[model samples]
Target: MADDAVTTGPEHTDEPVRVGLVGAGPWATMTQAPMLTGGPETRLVGVWARRAEAARELAEPYGVPAFTEYGALLDECEAVAFAVPPDVQARMATEAARAGKAVLLDKPIGLTLAEAAGLAEAIDSAGVVSQLMLSNRYRPRIREFLARAARFDTLGAQARQITRAFVAGPFAFGWRLEYGVLHDVAPHSLDLLDAAVGKIDRVHATGDTRRWVALTLEHTNGAVSQLALTGEVPEGGYTELAMFGPAGELRLDFRDLAGDEADSAAGWATVRREFAAAVRSGRPHALDVHRGLHLQRLIDQALAGLR
Candidate 1:
């Protein structure tokens, strides 16, 4: 895909957009389904998964129909929200875009640059409203932090996201264990650093993807960021980002956000509202497929640099 802008389809009047939830995992059940049903801008029209039973189970309480066929779900909804693995998301989301449904995507976009770029091409060709679920970008606290960080001269940044998800819980399963932190965790740090510091120009990395992965990113504006990520931490862990410069140091911690159910709900609510607004207005969102592709490229670069 070229570095050119992708045009959107024509705008429509403000009406509730019918959205289908794809994937029946914890993310879909906990966040996607609730946010889609709980919000006013979008309606939860249906739920679809690779497994019929899982889809039925998730859609039972919500009173929406469960779809065994992906096409049937796509036919019912004006938009689709994905909560599946990156590879699955790439393929299905491309199909949804080609079917003329606005897409609400999850991060990493795809498992590889080729998959990411192909999805971007499909989105561009379809000219539909598309947005990535970079949830933190929707939070008031994170928005405020970005605003404040922009006013400072950031010389460098340090970020770390450690977790025990691979050890237990709903997130313990799937591609997270196979691909490790780079695909699952690095997207958040990479996306935030690109927004806070500058576009990443170069990436250098070292460490093991299964245990620990560390990266040094040189931003286009010359500010560098160091990131350490792992999902195998045994005890307690944290997600933190700090920047230092002549303006002193600025920090944003995800400690409370990680533990606060209300904060997580609020973030997803804002994400859904904005995505529905984009669909109705035919306006491209800041965190769109193109942005996701850019981050995917950065991830590709970092992966290539890894030893």
Candidate 2:
């Protein structure tokens, strides 16, 4: 196979793939930048940001020159990694896909599902390798849970995914609270459960500023899940899921295990690497585009329920 051929490819020539990144945000710095730096198949050559100063700091260590213009960055890279706000993700992704540049977009694809559907359709038409960053699936705890599930499935009647706690990042654009937990963090676990078990038939949710969200999801597999997301808890709490199945039970707490210092984005590094390896082997990504779109729709329904 190609990936087995010397286990190395031309680095950054026409043979090697090039990646240009947009938004020198913390997510990009912590997740994509580090992963790309360590990956052999891709090169990080450019970064675009509104502020050149901030871009230089994050981009330079990765050996990529910073640019102030997003369009110029898109024009050059074979693929683009977007780490901007949810509202801006669609616009950039759609434009880049249309420009024939493959894209790696952050989740909560857009403010709503219709927007997400549009972007999905656009990316499909472009015939490019578009990937969404969904790392919770790669969490060893979660992956083990899935491995053990096998045929019997995880939840018996109903289980719950709980996400609670608060974070205060001064660098954030302050748009964090506007989207609610379902859009912000719930997608990770929700997408996991959806893939591990099945689709969510319905979700009823309610919450406010003090609490990120308090919600429940009912799966078509006859599993019901209660999800609690809030910020009142100290140390910025994290995600935990308990699945009740016929065979037995499975539980994983992403926060308690890692404590406060977990990279939060480390799982994503593996997810991207797996995707790259699959592309080289001509196999489907572990997670597919439809799953991403379906999760977006579930978020859409949950948000509508809130209203």
What's each prediction's TM-score? 0.94, 0.83
Per-residue alpha-carbon lDDT of candidate 2 for residues 22-53, written as tens digits (9 for 90 to 100) = 88788888777777667566678888876799
Count clashes in each candidate, considering only residues at least 3 apart in sequence or on different chains: 0, 4
Q: Candidate 1, 16: how far from true, in Å? A: 1.2
* Top candidate, metric TM-score: 1
Model 2 reaches what TM-score against the true structure?
0.83
**lDDT values for all models:** 0.86, 0.66
Model 2: residue 266 alpha-carbon error in angstroms: 6.8
Question: Candidate 2 regions off by >4 Å?
Answer: 1-15, 153-166, 170-173, 209-212, 259-268, 278-288
lDDT of 1 by residue, 149-217 (tens): 778788999999888868888888879999988988888888888888778888898988888989999
**lDDT of predicted model 2:** 0.66
- In candidate 1, list every pair of residues with a backbone clash: none
Model 2: which residue pairs collide?
156-244, 165-230, 165-231, 212-230
